[model samples]
Target: MTVSPAPREHDVLTDLLTQVGYRNEKAFAELYRRTSARLFGLCMRMMGDPDDAEETLQECFVVVWHRAPLFDPRLAGAMTWLMAIARNKAIDRLRQRPRTQGARDIDWDALPDTSPGPAEDGENDLAYRRLSDCLGALENRQRYCVRDAFFSGLTYVELAERMQVPLGTMKSWIRRALQQLRACMTP
Candidate 1:
């Protein structure tokens, strides 16, 4: 494979990002064309699996496309910010996968209930009630995704793989689910 030259530090990635915010696909592609290899390399190194690395690279690029305007050069230089995003995505992909044998069954009774004191307990109860009411309003699949993510600690990429759907579709379902939940819980 042909390697691209290193990205210039003074390049107007942020400017391209602003265009991306406005749904400029060409600009988005250009940004990806400039950055994908480096991000993919990081993903490959962090997540040893080739498939996982490719998926992480795609997810990172999608985020850059959708949320590029939010990038702040002052907090982190462009390469630094991009690499951090790539690293986080790779890590999340790595964690969703089980490295050992099948999941170990454990007794529920062995786990501690860390519910809070009286006042906090009351607040927790109220929050749980609100959450339940909100969750009840979601569509069946959306509810399932949220529950699996929250209770089982499954990340979106893992959820997508488990459900046999595209990552973008899974993200859309979860985003809509959260929006519905927020609308339900809002006073």
Candidate 2:
């Protein structure tokens, strides 16, 4: 059996990001070329509408252009950091729209899958199974809080109030649940 080598910390993408920090137009263009489709797709899934997704995607790139100098490779990969920025932007946009009192709940099935992973189909299935197992290991309340807060786009305050717990306790439940998930999922 052949085991793959552990992933490296640095990559060409981060190297290009360093160049972008110096206001290198070429590097920025290259970075966009390499990453735009995936991030745009992420925006699509998170926003659940193409028009809004496109606008959010544009906003994300503007952020990249201005914040390139602040990119730190030690905490996360360049692409990972960019992806988080796009996600947070989408979430912020989601939270900005007015909620209807009698509106129906969000249809999770309609959302596209934004997760990235191995190129192989088998590996993708394995990773998902592992993730499901890790999620299943959590207490019911913790699982609900984590899933609801992320997919339902509910604020922690709302979740806490719904569950009849203090805000800090709600945060702690999610945080510890996340820690358990990380431990279970990590090799």
Candidate 3:
């Protein structure tokens, strides 16, 4: 299960977001620092390409900076508001892409066997469950960074930017998380 932030954390984000509505650059920076990782994860999932995700994240923040005043705390939390913007931005980017870019001739009948045998299916299920439990053992931010880097295929530099951490810090987090996962799964 994912952990939700404490009320105090929510209040701080809310405060920063409110300040951002008033054109406070410092507040915006803090807000970005606190939220960018998760938002970038969402963008990566939606955009399916690191460059597109990065561009979408940038566009989302631009919209957030301009439309912060439109946020209604009664309706949603600050993160929710930001996520909506990121999601919309990702969708817009998807819509703007050339449809023909992904089009290709396919010989469907010549494709290799894609379905796993019973033994393989069982093994895959066990591995997935183990991986899920191991990932759950990680710190929330570290888990997010690992997922974004490995599952979304984002590079270290992209992960660092999304997480708003130094590249070294991002590398350390991923390394430690992987070590922990390995340890957990070894037995």
Q: Pick the candidate with the highest lDDT.
A: 2
lDDT of each residue in 59-145, candidate 3, tens digit only: 999999999988878877677688778877776776577754431222223434332322234234555579778988899888877
What ordering of candidates by TM-score runs from best to worst? 2, 3, 1
TM-score of 2: 0.67
- Per-candidate TM-scores read 0.47, 0.67, 0.51
Ranking by lDDT: 2, 3, 1
Clashing residue pairs for model 3: none
> Which model scores highest in TM-score?
2
TM-score of 1: 0.47
Give the Cα error of residue 154 in candidate 3, in Å.
22
Model 1 over residues 126-175: C-alpha lDDT tens digits?
55579777887888789888766643446787788878999999999999
- CA lDDT, every model vs. true structure: 0.69, 0.76, 0.74
Model 1 residue 45 lDDT?
55
Query: Once superposed on the true structure, which residue ranges of model 1 sit more than 4 Å away at CA?
Result: 1-9, 101-187
Candidate 3, residue 53: lDDT: 86
The Cα error of candidate 3 at residue 92, in Å, is 0.4
